[model samples]
Target: MRGFSLLDSSGLPVAKTCFDPANIPEALHLDVWRQASRCGAQVDSLQRDWRFRGRTSNWYTDGVVFSHTLCDATHYQRTPRHIRRGDSDCLVLKLQLAGHQQGIFGDFDHFSSPPGTLVLQDWAIPYNITTTPYEVMAVSIPRYLLRGSHLMYRRNPVITWQPDSPQARLLVPILTQTLKSLATASAGEADAYAAGITGLLDGLLLGDRELLQSKYRERDRLEDMRQYLSRHLSDPDLGADHLCRQFHCSRATVYRLFQREGGIATFILRQRLQRCMQEISRMGVVQKGFLEALAHTWGFSSRANLARHFKAYYGITPQQAVEAARSHQNEGQREMNAPYWRDAHRVSRWLESIAPGASPTEPAGAHGGTRQGPRELAGH
Candidate 1:
């Protein structure tokens, strides 16, 4: 179903509405509406005759922030002043899909993104970006799920674009192909597909040294702090103060990081729920009855409350999440055999032919292992 509305974190509708494009000017686009359509987004052809032409960006999510986007022929100049903040803080990555873009990061350094390239930015920063009517695909992942101890974009705050990095080259094609596949997927396939794409993107950004070393250090610190909390979820006293002591950070520091989340109490509860869902999912096929016990095991005092919140965050009941996890796991159980593992051999030979000097590390076939999807990734 195609629709348009702006929503807060609570998922409440609070905005002017436009469904049929005729009522709304082609130049005004809303984030939720653009996400729903799974195409590139643009607000274009204004009364003053300014043009903002970009396709709707594709996205999929399970709450707690994960999204992928593909922008085709995106050109937004003479954009109104009021819309500037909206465009900046959306907290999305921009991978150059095609064409060329040039801008200034600071005084000394200028940046340009050519086709088959990638760049990073946080809405928190002030910078300029422009593209010359090209195709670009990118993912907007929540800072929470990324693994490791570096703040990639926070300091550097930008990756202009690199066409030659082995990682960047591998990513552009994979993302392009994945977005193509996602266009035709069933609802059940959407989340996992989104997950895989997010994983690939995180790996690329986290894998880059410039991203990790300077700008993004605080972000990396917070992620490490969260993972440390997750490892201790079984403790009865697990909460914000405990985390503060464990990380030896100030209450102010902790509070600032989690301010948007209400407080530490809420953050801990959400993490516990996420971990419990992961555990239940690994159990494979199971009845909904198992969830009550699972909730209890996860330290929820009431099944009713747990179910309500879980469904709200995941867009599925805990029972449904379990079922999806089982189906996801079972699908992989069959894909792990030796014959299936051989698929990488063909991919390696294919890669070798196209880019003779492109071998960075040993191909997956050399390790003789199956390709696991994102669901199976170990929590940090």
Candidate 2:
């Protein structure tokens, strides 16, 4: 695939391309795969042995991109930084095949995706995905395509559709067949397939778009308030009153929006407490008084205040939490010098190696292990 005429045998500019991790050295396998999966998405190896096999057959056609990817154990994350609100927006759809992907995606916390689930993601929202060695078919559609049907782009960035639903039975097959068609179809045919999929999708979306519009409008406002609380956790005036003015909503309205989260005060407390916990997990209370310091920084009056709420929320005391974190930290310290995790320069080079670039013949890909990248990641 390194011949780099965009890697399409037909030389189509809106070309189909593929990536395999084997083109690079074994040590940088995870790094390059992360780079190609989604720009800025962080990839972590679940296993120290790194049974990493990420092969992607991707096609760009008519405002949509379809990809079929299979991989081994890995954790992928797109954090807040990947939420590009003003950019050319995209919604990614993941139709699970052989394996399950479980993680927190936007507001849907602690989700375990089942097989045949269609997960739609707004690129503006962050997601964390951990997958087993499994097969997945994904489609990336631009936001404008849905806008034609009155779908709110940012309302539900992460939403799952079960395959057994009435709507899913109708829409899921079209989505699946159209995405798979990209692998074998030529440029003209693939583009038409993509357009056809989008058209049919728009019709389905149109049926519900009008109904979801207002519901999403309310969700968007709630999301805005949540974002505000995250950025201003330490601010003294960070409560329902502040949110009311900041977002120009009534006190009653603010309460109504967060009714599911136990009202405005609880949401703020949870955000502050969440950050405090993350700090403890990452650093494990380095100093004697760091626990109190962490509490104060997050607006807790004292260590006792944080401990009381933390125990209520997580069923553990602050000291106990630190002890657990320390245990995990000590375990990771052993791998701090391991070869598979070493050599930043080599990883950078391999990450840089993914150019707009395979042979065309591996029905299973070029070599063993699904496919190979650069030289061998060709679309057959």
RMSD of each: 20.4, 10.7
Weakest ten-residue segment in model 2 by summed lDDT: 356-365
In terms of lDDT, model 1 sits at 0.44
Residue-wise C-alpha lDDT for candidate 1, range 276-360, written one tens digit per residue: 6445534645765677777666667667767887666444466655543343221212222332122222222221111111111
lDDT winner among the candidates? Answer: 2
Backbone clashes under 3 angstroms, per model: 21, 4
Give TM-scores for every candidate, taking all chains together and pairing residue i with residue i.
Answer: 0.38, 0.55
Instruction: State the TM-score for model 1.
Output: 0.38
